[model samples]
Target: MKTSLILGTALALIASAGMAEQITVMSWGGTYSQSQVEAYQKPFTTETGITVVSVDSDNPAIPIKAQVEAGNVTVDVVDIEYADAIRLCDEGLLEEIDPAILPRAPDGTPATDDFLPQGLSDCAVGSIVFSTVYAYDRTRFPDSPPRTIADFFDTGKFPGKRGLKKAPKALLEMALMGDGVPADQVYDLLSTAEGVDRAFAKLDTIKKDVVWWETGAQAPQLLADGEVVLSTAYNGRIFNAAVSEGRPFDMVWDGQVYEYNLFAIPKGAPNKDAALEYIAFATGTQRLADQAKWISYGPARKSSAPLVGLYQDGKTEMAPNMPTNPDNMKNALASSYDFWVDHESELTERFNAWLSAS
Candidate 1:
């Protein structure tokens, strides 16, 4: 049923492109969405006169799948995590994007080589490299800080409520890593049911004191309000809280789950051609570099790294705080898109069951 619906949508979209006027892009809301709007949407609009309608979602991929399955596709392009990008492409919910459509670099390098290894796929193009990192309020843990993944689960040592996201993706990996599973071996161990149970068992230690956050802004807010002592959050969100807002928070880079965010065209889009054009223009070297001014996330294109400069505030250097920074990469684990693609549904069910259990 879903396959037929997706096929129908794709054919309809191909036929409607000439008639459709504007392209709608769905993205994770808040400051991150604002960055894409400033860097890509508006500039694309200015350059081609095609209106880029921006929409917000907790995660765009959810609705993209729903819409494609229902054969009621509305959004043209969506900014989604790498795992979902790969999963949806395999499910035939996205259009196959060609490498030839992407723009060449200023130095004449083709898009295929200029983009980092994680940036390109048959159905999507990555835009940024972001991470899930835990942070603590300095005011709460002044004498000793929560430095490692193990420290995040040590409620006896830390002695405060720990904040975590509601979803299972990174939290499970963090639990495994916190239990002394080597960063490189987290996914391998998690491939089995015993590993899944082990992760939940580790989380059980802190479950009573855990405050779950659903949005990127909520983690930092939880710390600032004295609600949680340690909270896992995007590195950029913590950076904004600690640096931009003058908060006393510090990011814990150990056991971080770094991942890519890709821009993919849904299977049946209202403006298919315009969506392709938008992706090509937005992922260019200058445009991707421009996105970093609004957020600390590293651009997907390697050529854009040299072009990245100061933050919007003009004083802060964006490189030092990026998740891709050399200093932060030592203990980081690249979130396995393949692992989640194969295990997401099953693990998510188990995670929810664990969440509701006594």
Candidate 2:
């Protein structure tokens, strides 16, 4: 009887260990992923005993769509841009995440009311507000650094290779801005054929001097390697290089394009419940604020703003470095989700053709 009882207890222990939960999260790699790891993944695992597996992607949306359509979904959660979140959700590739699952602010504000406008969606929850801004190697352009967007295209003045994202989204908007278009009128003008031509014409000026980067980490490396004097990069990545790594880089916020980065679950996630639990925990007010310490991106929740403080280094103030800072917003443009959803494919094709032309 004693041997049988001991055997039963051993079997039960093995069964319980096998049932421990794990969820995979895909995100744009580099410091951004590191930030999420520190702020969301680590604490989450500690608190819930669920293993969080981190994966890197050039863009999470592509894999999410491919996985869901192929009927072999692997990632449980994805960190995606606001535009992709809406587009993927509309295509039924992502699971619907009810906002009620999110926690309210410490002051008792509801999750919906506490998040910034457009922060909460039918299928995703906003995490950070980041920007695509141009930055230059301070050591390279110590005396006569490029200041405005136009300078990014003026090879005669800046006089070195410029690094740009391989995508047409922010580049088109910035091109028009460089060509002297105002931030507010950029999308309206881009909706017209002539405005599209003007933007491309501006890009043509620096086409030969442009080195295209597909991932967030490559942008900072381009500047560091002296491959490009000025590169348009995600602001948080630049901040990580400049502050944490002590790189001599400075950002040009004039004509910056800012947008939200949200968390979503792909359809058929193996651990759907754990993924939802992770999202709810990560998007909470404190978690959002915690992310700000690791990177310069602004928290998506209004309540998270007050809690934002110094960077992880414990000296550099995070607010002034954020893209949403009042100083940075003077000439900033908000990325239009509607515009991208409508024209991404058409413009991407044109941009690729332009890249191939002699």
Candidate 3:
């Protein structure tokens, strides 16, 4: 009888172990993370019988480097910005994502040809295209609202605190744009010493009125709480706040800097095969399209565009709200991943110095 009981316990333990195949994915938290959960993680788990443990970070890129260097890898997959993906891959901290492993389109087009340009990189696969757009609370300015990024920096005219990311990435680009640099010439202007100085000088104009945010969640919260009347946020955050939570925020697409968030498997990741499999599955045509229903960020795949429709509310048409919408792109600038990859570290140092100056 004791042997029978022991045998039953052993069988149960083995079964539990088999069923517990797990992968931890670190992502920027809030609705963006929730979108991934709804569109990818949950579906991946259900289909692959793999448990996904979701983790949040102000920026996953920062911690991924630390984890890889320390050789104490806990995360299997991380969703990070494109520049970080490129930088990390260059630093030998991330695993290469072979384009061949990616799922192709239904028309039998190869993944390379199917994905948008720069969508598939050596170390990462582009997941979604998000943007940094300033949104103002309609209740704050019912009549004269900020119409452009220039207006966001005009404290005298706007007369309210503004929220911006603490990082230099999008802010510098927008600052240059607000200073009348053409969208096409933003990166070129930023490349020289003069261009860098111009961006910072422009930033100095409204630095005092700017409330800096470190996390994606903090942007909309600042606007909601009136800590900031206008906040530069990921388009999806403001969209979710306005659509889901019934906030009175409205977006300013002018001078918005759009960029991609990608999924990169870190070196020494515990479940490398499962992580790779998850990326392939998650970035597939259906999964990318599915993500749009949960978040307004456009999918990286061209095929997914037609599949995108109304938001979760079913009343608001999602097409017009996307960062990739043609109308939205009129005055927009793509955040230069190459520029950021080249300058991220130096810019971080410069920003810190400037932040500490006054």
Winning candidate number (lDDT): 2
Better of 1 and 3 by TM-score: 3
How much lDDT does candidate 2 score?
A: 0.92
lDDT per model vs. reference = 0.91, 0.92, 0.91
lDDT by residue for model 2 over 1-358, one digit each (tens)?
A: 9999999999998876654488899999888999999999999999999989999998889888999999999999999989889989999999998888899999999999999877988899999999999999988877888899888888888899999999899999999999999999999999999999999999989988989998889999999999999999999989999998999999999999999999999999988899999999999999999999899999999999989999988899998988878999988999999998888889999999998999
Error of 3 at 261 (Å): 0.9
Best by TM-score: 2
Candidate 1 per-residue C-alpha lDDT over 1-358 given as tens digits, one digit per residue, 9 for 90 to 100: 9999999999999877645668899999888998999999888878888887789999898999999999999999999988788889999999999989999888999999999877998899989999999999998878888889999999889998989999999999999999999899999999998898899999999999999999999999999999998999998889888777899999989999999999999998878888999999999999999999989899999899889999989899988888888898877899887788788899899888888998
Give the higher-lDDT candidate: 1 or 2: 2
lDDT of 3 at 210: 83
Question: How much is the lDDT of residue 16 in candidate 3?
Answer: 65
True-structure RMSD, every candidate: 6.4, 2.7, 2.8
C-alpha RMSD in Å of predicted model 2 compared with the true structure:
2.7
Model 1 CA deviation exceeding 4 Å by range: 1-21
Q: Local error of candidate 1 at 132, Å?
A: 0.6
